[model samples]
Target: MSTLAAMIAADYGTIGDILRERARETPERLAVVMETGEAVTYAQFDALADRVAAALQRDGIQPGEAVAVCALSSIPYAALFLGALRAGVAVAPIAPSSTPGAIAGMVADCGARLFFLDAGVAEAQKPAPVPARQIALDGSAVGEAFDAWLAPEGATPAPVEIGPKHPFNIIYSSGTTGTPKGIVQSHGMRWKHIFVGDTIGYAHAPVSLLSTPLYSNTTLVCFFPTLAGGGTVVLMKKFDVVRYLELAQTHRVTHTMLVPVQYRRLMEHPDFDRYDLSSTRMKFCTSAPFSAELKGEVLRRWRGGLVEYFGMTEGGGTCILMAHEHPDKLHTVGRPAPGHDIRLIDEDGREVGPGVVGEIVGRSASMMNGYHGRADKTAEATWTSPEGLSFIRTGDVGRFDEDGFLTLMDRKKDMIISGGFNIYPSDLEAVLATHPAVVEAAVVGVPSDAWGETPVAFVAARGQADPEAIRAFVNDKVGKTQRLAEVRFVDALPRSHIGKVLKRELRETWQKSPTT
Candidate 1:
């Protein structure tokens, strides 16, 4: 067996160790390339990681301690993340787009001893005091500069043993109010993902392009696997349609992970067809609901295997829908992955038979440990089965077909009860997507004295689509109970960084101005 293959086949391994091996095997190979033209060799990346680890250790950071980073994707940030892992420390990657208070709360909640950020985040978060000592990822005056903070280049960190159950990262969910819950993923969970990557296509040293922020698990799923497989990583600090196309063509990127909205925007861009993306071997989408129409479009126009992963950052069960493999099952999110037991349960926690709509819950080897420091919240998210197995409650309502394909309805909390019928927002959104002029749409439950609760549509339209006309088109197609009571035109839907339409914000807008 090849040395790399043997290393990957080991019963257990940490990402840091695998990276060190890659550096040993292919020192001269490109490890990372930034959009701004900076690049690093595998050897250089490994050395930098060593220095980072050594520095963390020298500063009295212990194993199992955490560090916080809020910065745009860059080589230094990536190196620091890897370095922390080497020192057996967990990383809390805060979103730079978060409110200053949220950023400060996350740093404190994660119990980080050091916080690293760039100039932009430093300036924006000046109003909120970060609990940890700050270091600047960029050479700005806000904190100690990264270059100066590094342990000398030749320094090696004291060896530390990393176990499977140790926290790999604490990913904070985007909460609308209060502090977001931190989902603690383990090294074991990440190993499972890395193994899956090898089985799929990451073993080929393919050039992977990532446009999403480093703080997102959506980005790391692709990021970690590419590095583990010794592939070159191409990062975009921010996504731009033209720039994305240019990079894809220039880098001949073979792998990528994009959210559904990104796919929609790229496919709709006028210059999309101009780029040559034949080198792409696999494309992944997750974090938000992926429309069947968009999946079909990607399959038709994009080269590579278009796979949509359905799961949560908490990592309960994952559904992989390979659009290219199952054209007939485009509407469904595919069957449960091997070894992943997915079940649909009624509101009362009773298992439902096939073809019955219920809350989706799943159990797998790749589950998260728990929500960091929130045992009560963690318990709320889990449901124990009759067999005494714990399953993560997806909070998503779906039905499993006889063939085992899972078709999502909507979030259980987002279901609208108009007169007594359960109206799924996705059903309305799907109808709106069929309209020739509707670019994108979101549906939310609005207060209605007549129906108790009513469906309202928020739509982003093309050139000159009338909101009333679009509403009429959608309402005509849906059942009476699912019909929209009002339609509001929007320039674009408010979305989280990972492309999930912020339905709560839409609902708030309707509540604030019901007539509009």
Candidate 2:
């Protein structure tokens, strides 16, 4: 395997360099299209980005500063992102779906100096600590719009020299908890992961669908790889079933990086076959795996490259199942990508054999520097072994097959041990989702009087899923202990922006409910 240095031998030093190089190479290539239906070519994007950088500098945001963007997917957003990178500023993408308190916490955590707000969205979203100024992305103040402010009079800000180690972003994790700590990504890992993504599992994929929100680390898997390869990005503001299929066909979308629920929705769409998906080549499912049954359903309808990966934002875009390599078909997340060292170790930190389910650990050029501003958590996640490998504990129970395929069995903290049997929520959820009427399923261990921890099933049904039928369905499929103690037939499951069923919320909700 080539070293990361060899991989980046001809690399551009910083994000600014990549922007300039793209502009020089393909000045007229369409770079981004906004929600308002405006398109900007490479030349236009770079120029306006320079203007935003200068405008920001004029407002006292200098190199290496932090900026919070509380806007929806728009043309102005693309410009703002580029400008932040060009000006050597870090970006925090605050989603509209987040509450005002959450937005404030994130912006405050990143310590943004100035926020470029889209009032319609930002006013609704209301990012915290509200930056020094709130410049609008759209709407004119006395006929002077954001673009007019960027009259291109000021020269592009001088490039700030950055090593691979300089921080690129302080991305917060998806789940809203007590406080979301930032994930610090280094400049080195940012580009390294992009390159690894292009060659490891996905090639220079053209026209990837951004149906998933732009606020995720998974978004990095889609957005940067295409941008680096000079391919087109088919952006979607939100998930609309028909629009997804239509755009995929219209743009001849070659790739899609989405969560499992999104894939399930695509397959369940009434108008699934209304457009041709022959051009769709790769599908990436990794923020929680879709059931193999769901993958089969998806492939049956849309058929293309199907790959699953297992990794967190903290782990970087490091682990993957390469296209066309199907060994442990449904169980494994596949082998380690090049330059990544991975292992499964027991509780005492000793290496476990291939079949022994233990905690998965890894190290790579792509691992985050550390979780931002939390040393104790950082120490818990990342540590160095005697052999000098920078090991990161995945907190996922996994094992490698003799055939070298890697499988995730369960999360260490998420496992339910009852009556001497261990059960993974994913395993139970998979069994539950296969039932005819189950639209969504979340399995969490609730307190049990007899067993230390016991599994309870919470389901969101589609057409006719009542508690009895669904409980019988799961009981018939999984082991006796895996059967739900009680089932909650809720109208809908709590979901994050990218649509992973928020089991944490469901667990809390179920705890308070007398029915469960």
Candidate 3:
């Protein structure tokens, strides 16, 4: 085995082992810091995790069992996650924004014997049923306090053999309920992400400021790498543009991960240029459609390497666009990362030639094992090639340019079939975004009498933009078959927790409206 591989196998095979190593190497170094000024040193954090793991083991929670946590970002919350992994248990971090029913469903779906929540979450989800054994991160009447629930200090749980294929965590789909699919990421996948940080300069004692929720994979992508590299991670419970800039400047944060919406807000902030963001070394964006314009603006203004990652949480394949390096290729997500095999296939499962739009299917080292407890659904997501190699089917439709960069067209479900002509909403939305008066735009297909479905646009205007005029401008730019059926002005487009435009919600709202 290679020298690095041998070291990893000996001392840092799992998340728990790595944390233990860091604690022993740099006990005084700060491991995590929250916006509220709370911080944990490596030694203290590791001991706290030991206590938590011991407590879980005392409660008869066996290895490979799942522990669910639904709370705002906090120091204790981070400890709980590490503690579960330390004991060979899987941590399931559910979205705090989910409805009570959805929260309950996710906790149950993970088969968690212990549920952890903050006072606010417990109060908000009082109506939802939880596990018999519950603990509160923030002292609340709903459950036992975190300090009280932990085992004695310095007490450690018995360690179990951790293999590469062992499940590390189960991340439930956002805004999902009624048999929510849990994406099971294995230890090997996470290890790959952690060690690969060396190549990206994450091992240079980088300090990452994570503004997104802990439940999001987007946040974890930076969070785990920062800690694994023996650096500090600053957490933010919620994102506020002013506060974010203040913290980034104060901490001299070198790295961060943000979705596209957050980037837009930061750029549009009136005092965005006032802050000294020179300390930032790398800034990553993902989880939504990042426009070429936005990428250009950040590359011009932001003092860092701006990268855009295009992939799914299921982890089939990832394409990285280094905006600072590939200034001309801003319109496309970069070529597949090393070891990622990507291909385009038509609806009938036939391979499409270069430049032909088709659904993207990919296979990679980081791919998930499968959906938890749903073999049928898992099988549906996998597409077997003529060579019998399996690949994960990304529901996105895109075409590869001659340069090998992938330009996303639209989601398969979002494609509008108007009079038998396929229209990509992104094409119309891109034109709408070019208008000076339009801040942002989203297009969705609506049921029509004459056509099978027609495209309708919802736009957030920058100034006094007439809906009719905006519609006319966009219609003139697009093809006749892809012209907008109607245009509606809104203060903002509806978005999910991760900044993805909620087109499904828009369709439902439009269908129920009198104008439609």
Candidate 4:
């Protein structure tokens, strides 16, 4: 037996250890591949991580210190992410799409000693005063070239004793304008994810195609599992439907994780059926509300298991709806995963029974350590049970069916209360989407003199549809209290990078132009 293989056989607890083992077990297997055709073998991938760790150590980055990277998905970015974990350094992956102020705030918040970014972000974030020394990942003149900054070939990183509580990476909450709070996920949390992947066929050395940005927790849930299982990860810097179909056909990708909007686009594509996706073993969706209609379409047309995960990035409990297995339960996000405890509590923090709409609180083994440097915020987000077990409050309002399936109503903050009547925006949005002339819709509560608050809808129409006519149609279908007071036409609804509708933006726009 190989020496490295024997070492890994004893125990491969961490991600870096798993990479080392995969290099020894399948040295020539493709570890990562870019949409542009750049690829790396497991052996080379391990070596690159080692170099990154060595360089950070040489620069006096202690095990607990952090580094930040803001760039598009690429080979070097992926390696640097894993390498930092190897050196016991946490990574804060800021989105390049974020405003310059948000980027600067995150870099400062994480206390990053070295900021690694591509030329594009460097150019965009000029004069933002990044506190750390910069290293250019794309060899741009904005900072030192990545290759030149890396430790010399054949260099080795000092061994790091990674513990369960060690910070793996800091994922900032999804927001484009503000400096979102950083969620500090420990190595133990990630290990749970990898283990969960094994149960769902991620251990088969699958070829996974990923289109989501590396900065998202939505991507890492799939990305880390594929790599840990010695599978090849094919990344796209940006998502294009035709390009995605072509890569899936060419690579025979076995697994994928796309947000609901991406799936809707693929299913609605003109030639979606022409692509051969028979090799797919599973397709996962998360990060947004997936409508039952879209899930049905995917199950009918796509050739794989369809699973929708309902949870938060802060790592509370997760509910997995295996769509193929539970066709009748398409409206519900499945039961809480094994060993995960999910509960519902009223506004007063008292536990509510099934069939009652309340805030979703969950507890599990795979929870985040806390919000970085925000103890008050962390405490505010947590709810202590009678047994003193802390649960993460999801801020989502949902109810459990008789069979224990969860049906999400809407975000707690988004629920509209008009004259003491509670109205879920999703309920109104669902009816609006069914209108023949409407492409999509969003409903937000607007100020009202009589009702205190009233429902108003902003819709993206298929073509020239009369706003009054559509509003009348919807009001006729829903109850008087649930009816929309006004309908405004928009070319498109504002969305975050992960495809969540920015309801705050919609509300702000309405407040600015309250002509109606």
Tell me the alpha-carbon RMSD of every candidate.
Answer: 1.1, 3.5, 1.8, 1.8
Candidate 4 is scored at a TM of 0.97
**Candidate 3: TM-score?**
0.97
Clashes of each: 0, 2, 0, 0
Off by over 4 Å in 2: 1-12, 125-131, 140-145, 148-154, 200-205, 419-421
lDDT of 3 at 42: 94
Ranking by lDDT: 4, 1, 3, 2
- lDDT for model 1 comes to 0.92
Please report, as a residue range, the 10-residue window in candidate 4 with the lowest summed lDDT: 3-12
lDDT (Cα atoms) of all candidates against the true structure: 0.92, 0.72, 0.88, 0.92
Which runs of model 4 end up more than 4 angstroms from their true locations?
A: 1-12, 176-179
Clashing residue pairs in candidate 4 are: none
Q: Which ten contiguous residues of candidate 3 have the minimum total lDDT? A: 3-12
* Better by lDDT, candidate 3 or 1: 1
Candidate 2 lDDT over 183-217, as tens digits, reads 88877878776765565334453677787766677
Candidate 1: list runs displaced more than 4 Å: none
Pairs that clash in candidate 3: none
- For residues 1-516, write the lDDT of model 4, one tens digit per residue: 865435334423788988988898899999999999999999999999999999999999999789999999999999999999999999999989888888999999999989999999998899687999999999999899999999998788999999888999999997633459999999988888886887678888989999999999999999999998889999999999999999999999999999998998999899999999999999999999999998999999999999999999899899999999999999999999998999999999999999999999999988999999999989999999988999999999999999999999999999999999999999999999889998889999999988999999999998779999999999999998999999999998888888899999999999998955
lDDT of 3 by residue, 303-363 (tens): 9899888998888888988888899999998989888989999989989988999999999
Top TM-score hit: 1
